[model samples]
Target chain A: MTLCRYWRLDRHPEGNTRFERFLSLHEEACAPLAPGEVRIAVEWLSMDAGTRMWMSPRTDGYQPPLPLGSRMVGLVLGRVIESLDPAYPPGVRVRGFGQWADVATVVPALAGLEVVDETVADPRQHFGALGMNAWTALVGVREVAAVRPGEWLAVSAAAGATGSLACQIGRNLGARVVGIAGGAEKCRFLLDELGVDMAIDYRAEDVSARLSQVPGGVHAFFDNVGGPILDAVLGNMAHYGRVAICGMIAGYDSDVAMPGPAKFDQVLMRRLRIEGFFIPDFLERGAEFLPQLRTWLDEGRLAVRFDETQGLENVPAAYERMLTGRNIGKVIVRL
Target chain B: MTLCRYWRLDRHPEGNTRFERFLSLHEEACAPLAPGEVRIAVEWLSMDAGTRMWMSPRTDGYQPPLPLGSRMVGLVLGRVIESLDPAYPPGVRVRGFGQWADVATVVPALAGLEVVDETVADPRQHFGALGMNAWTALVGVREVAAVRPGEWLAVSAAAGATGSLACQIGRNLGARVVGIAGGAEKCRFLLDELGVDMAIDYRAEDVSARLSQVPGGVHAFFDNVGGPILDAVLGNMAHYGRVAICGMIAGYDSDVAMPGPAKFDQVLMRRLRIEGFFIPDFLERGAEFLPQLRTWLDEGRLAVRFDETQGLENVPAAYERMLTGRNIGKVIVRL
Candidate 1:
């Protein structure tokens, strides 16, 4: 019998940040795969901010919170070791929702398991240019935000995985991009590496004052962090602007739902559209999005900087790093 | 020489309700009409909640708050007695933005001047079925909210002009409607007169509890009074629901803009689309919407109840009554 090491939810967290106290690492003998289940030898764990909601006891979240004593869930990139499902057979590298574990057993359909392409220069690209982040950025900038060429597109959490890709996608679509993030380094990364038209260090800068200086006003916003940042963007939106909410990391950890932007009145005054979109909701259309993303990847237009933490034991710290805006790009655990 | 007695915005308003304090009636000899100007013998002044924003000193409103010392502007229905513009001939009954006075002068272009149908059963219907409120309801319900047949559409401020018409329009579109209003009388009017699928007196009942009882959560929301009312609706929205913001009467009078819904994260949780639309933006499309509204009016599918206040001196009281949700349906002042 093989040993499986994973993080388990001990309790629902209350307060600012208590990743370790509520979640504890545990080891167990790997169980036999259930019918339609596939066991993956996880090579990497994707640290996502959206999963933070599942830790809360809030039933009003996108989906119900993870129950106590359940394995902490997250996206996993790995090679299949054994499988009951014929589709996700052993030896193929796959990427999808799985536990934060060294060995993760998943139901193929529920986990959205799919065999990833092996032809990439790096296997980690499965969690990079061709990953869910890329797909989210593509659909968000193109469809949800409905950003047209020559318009100004502002992205919050601009140095995070999804936001970084979104900034590039906005540029690829010929829209002027403004990336907003915490710290001067992230701003530099946005301006120098991502080549965004403007980069605002939200931690130091007056976001509203900076955004209000945009020529006509921000036409489209791909938002990841919502709160005061949302209000800053809302107040500076041009008439008929659209906001695509990708994540609300600012309020994700709270027991209480976040109060909406203080500048909510601007939605009417500016005749704006605010739409909240979850990537899982668009998973079925991934095949439709992959071609454009692949082209961008081949053209070197979409690049992801992976902040790798060694071992599954470091997963919580990496997740906290990403969530707390300490990481510059995609944070992943090398299991 | 004609003596024009009109309400003048002498100072920017502060506090909750201050209708008479900030605005004072002034009499002056009518000046010669400017080029492209048309003069109307004001018969009716429609009391609109949206105009309350102009009373504040806030610049972030839908339009820059009406200039201090300018005549208070609102929708006026009357006979055109004098005109420099040939399009609006003398004696033609018209409706457009004009000053609150016995003799109101307007520039045809800026005021959205239109020669209304004199063939209607009642001239008040011009401010009802064929009016801006009607147009707002049609665009808000059918277009912005995008309520489909059999879907549950919830309307806030259901007793007021736009919300009242929206309930009927939603029903006419074959959607189930839940009307939320201030008092039992308004709820009764919604259920007994408007025949809405359901009616909730917001003051007496738990709106969130009442809304959560909807089998499938509310699929569309046409919101007028934003605040806790918005939060209640947001928490109960079905996945991919649409919100058409027609007015935020709850927040309009505040010098400081109202805080957004407490349950704002529901936008992302429910994957909702919240859009704000203004009537003036869709005024040009009125001709396209008129046939349908007119047909509804003719078929008796649409009806209006006017809460009329006699004389121009009572305009402030009428405006206060409507703003405070003390009046039902359309509130109007006869000049």
Candidate 2:
């Protein structure tokens, strides 16, 4: 028997998650792998704002809420220690949705496991810049918003993982990229590191006023933090503009219902298109996306940063940091 | 000189338009046709919800607010009585944006005049089913929302001009169409006349409850009324649902600011797409659309109904009736 430590849903979150109160850490003994199953020793777990949403009672079309006392669902990168499946032999690294635990015994078919390439410089990058974050950014910029040359693309949460990658991709697509971040430090990072044309410090400055100064209004908006920021951008949208809704971290913690965008009428007036998408829906295009992402990373055209915490014990704290914008880039727990 | 009676903007509307206070009826001495100009005897006018939006303080990208003392802008079908331009000879029927008047002296270029074909049974059809209304519906269904076979389409204001046409188009495109209208009478017309798969009397039934009975949730929503009705539909949207935002009559006459759709967060959860568009943007495709529409009308695959009021003198009353959902189909004025 193998001892596995994991976090389980203790209670439904009422408002902002008090992770300690909502998640209970527990240890369980794992039985030997059954037929078609593989045992993985998890090395890294992705912590995202979306994790917070999964703890609440299911309200929208997102994945169903975790049942009370169930292991918390998360994306994990692990090495296969024992396997009954030929495709995932022992010693191969794999990535799949699994419980946040040190050891996970998963049926390869049920877990939707994908073998990770060992040749990559940093395997953790697979979970950050080159994984779901990059996939979502590409889908939003290229497929949804269809950012074109000379168009002004504004991205919210520009210093966050998906937002930073989106800014780079937008610029590469020849769009004039403007980033909206929280403070002067993130603003400087957006301008100097990510090379966005303009970075608005949403905390210190009025975003609408700053956007009005842009010669032509924003042609596309990539929204991650939806709320007043989404409303502000809507007010400044150019005619026939498009918005790709990726995440709404701002309202994730609200106990009370969040109000709809006040300036939604502008959607009619400006003839804007707003589309929300999940990365899993476009995973079939991963073969097409991964190679391009690899090339850009090698050429130094794409950059990735991580706000990492050590040990499984800090997973909840890392999630809290991600929700509050306390961490920059992708937040991860190194198991 | 020909004496032409016209309605001009006397003041900006404060709340619900009190036409008597805001519009001034004037008897003007019509000027003779100048070089490249034509004199038209206005015959029919198209009244739509968009007309109300144009009178408001400019908030969106629609046409600029009509300046006080200026003739109200609208679509008119007229017979040319005199012309200096060979392209438009006397007795030729022309359609373009013109003032609400008995006669209008317009330069072909300035008025954006197009000599309309007289072969159709009713030239008035050009101002209703064959005109902007049909064009908006087709674009929303075919181009924006892209309704497909076996999909469930829920349309708000489904008994109104564009909504009714959109329901038919959705059916023609092979989708199961459901309609949301204001009254029992309109709902019957939608089911009996328009051949919609389902019809909900929004005033009498619970829209959300009715929609829940659909085998699959709404795959697409054509929103004409954008308030709580939009919210109700949002609550029941299918995964990857698309919404075409054509009009929002609910807020047109409001004295206070209208709140946004409360259930809009479903937009993110369901990975839905909401696109707002104006018919004018797609007018370039009118050549392709007109022939198809004419064919559909001939085959009885499409039908048009009008809630027409005679005489331009009652234009304001006709408009008021349309805004209140008293009119069941395309509202028109015969002059």
Please report the TM-score between candidate 2 and the true structure: 0.97
Q: Give the docking tier of candidate 2.
A: medium
Candidate 2 lDDT for residue A134: 90
What TM-score would you report for chain A in candidate 1?
Answer: 0.98
lDDT of candidate model 2 versus the reference = 0.85
Cα lDDT of model 1 by residue, B86-133, tens digit: 999999988999988889999998999999887797899888877899
Off by over 4 Å in 2: A255-257, B107-110, B255-257
Cα lDDT computed for each candidate against the true fold: 0.91, 0.85
Provide fnat values for all models in the order shown.
Answer: 0.87, 0.69
Model 2 C-alpha RMSD vs. true structure (Å) is 1.7
In model 1, where do residues sit more than 4 Å from their true spots? A14-18, B15-18
Residue-level error in angstroms, candidate 1, position B273:
1.2
- The residue-by-residue lDDT of candidate 2 on A200-248, one tens digit each, is 9999999999999888799999999889999999889998899999988
